[model samples]
Target: MVDRESDTYSCECAMFEHMGILCRHALKVMVHVGVCRIPSHYILKRWSRDARDVLPDHLKCYQKDSD
Candidate 1:
């Protein structure tokens, strides 16, 4: 089963949390279930071509240092 929170989702596979990107398991479930769009928070703007664009308001200050 996939576990979902307000801004992120995970599966027992845990690859996204470990790698800072979507896991294969998550992508498979999304495609199989016809989830057409990724939740905004899950999109890493740094990976986008327009990486300089500011994160949306709800996601502001959402990132924290793991240390």
Candidate 2:
């Protein structure tokens, strides 16, 4: 089963309906169904692949650039 707290799943249906994306709860269900990888369509907001072109490009703080 997908962990709502740890996973990207949201439990708000209205949010999902308005956004046409899976809420955390739905994501959990999808995880339970054995979907190890989350598709681009399932994510909501600007950080997902759908928003890749729209969102600004920024380096990850956790990543260290190689010399």
Candidate 3:
């Protein structure tokens, strides 16, 4: 189900809740509703291309390697 007011979505598949990934059903709903982009909250940092570029404040002391 898509809740426009809260910008939340749910599916009987429970893929997002279980795997932290948006399911095909949810994607279809988003497309049908004309949502051009996926919300930031749904994009896990670990899954992004720049995931390694960012570190928590507590781990900031560590530096990334050039190679």
Candidate 4:
């Protein structure tokens, strides 16, 4: 369900809450509501390309040097 006034969306799948990615149901709701852009809150930082730009000293060894 989507509430246009509050700009909130809910789905019975709970995919977003558990997996941090919006499910088809939510996407459909957004489309139906004419949402052109994804709301910032729905974008998970960990899933972004720059998510690991900064790494801890210990974990740095596991990362392949860009250069």
Candidate 5:
């Protein structure tokens, strides 16, 4: 059934783990629903290189002035 396939895809794509971003399965659903643009948040998250910057500035010991 289509519902089962969709559910499987959603699980496989890990959509439930990240609601803020669409997994590939969600994108497929969007295509089925005739959605375009795929939203900047999703695409941005996919292509973003900023994930490495999530650590706090203070966490970088080298960046602190030598005591």
Candidate 6:
């Protein structure tokens, strides 16, 4: 069920928790209810376009290897 007040959208299948994305059922509800924007809490940073923005330089392996 799509809980707008609490911003907790869920289905019995529990796919959102495992996969970190809204399931088809939840998506359908959002569309049907005319939800224009997805809540930020439900969005995963890694899945977003700026996923790499928060990464450290070393983690991104930008440094050259020492010979």
lDDT of 4 by residue, 1-67 (tens): 7877777787999999999999999998898778999888888888887677777877868777643
Tens-place lDDT per residue, model 5, 1-24, is 134333322446565466656666
Give the deviation of candidate 6 from the true structure as CA RMSD: 4.6
Work out the TM-score per prediction. 0.56, 0.38, 0.73, 0.75, 0.36, 0.71
Where model 6 places Cα greater than 4 Å from the true spot, the runs are 53-59, 62-67
lDDT (tens digit, per residue) of candidate 3 on 14-62: 9988999999999999999999999888999878877867777677666
lDDT of each: 0.69, 0.58, 0.87, 0.84, 0.54, 0.80
User: What residue pairs clash in candidate 5, if any at all?
Assistant: none
lDDT comparison, 4 vs 5, better candidate: 4
lDDT tens digits by residue: candidate 6, 5-63: 89778899888899998888988888888889887888998898777667686676653
Predicted candidate 1 versus true structure: per-residue lDDT over 1-67, tens digit per residue: 6555453457886777776788887787778866789877677777785663466767655645212
What lDDT, from 0 to 1, does candidate 5 have? 0.54
Every candidate's CA RMSD: 10.2, 9.1, 4.1, 2.3, 7.8, 4.6
* Runs with alpha carbons beyond 4 Å of true place in candidate 2: 1-12, 19-21, 49-67
Which of the two candidates, 3 or 4, achieves a greater TM-score against the reference? 4
Candidate with maximal lDDT: 3
What is candidate 2's lDDT per residue for 1-67, written digit by digit as tens? 3454565455645566676756667766776778788865555566554454443346333334412
Residue 25 lDDT in model 4? 91
Better of 3 and 5 by TM-score: 3
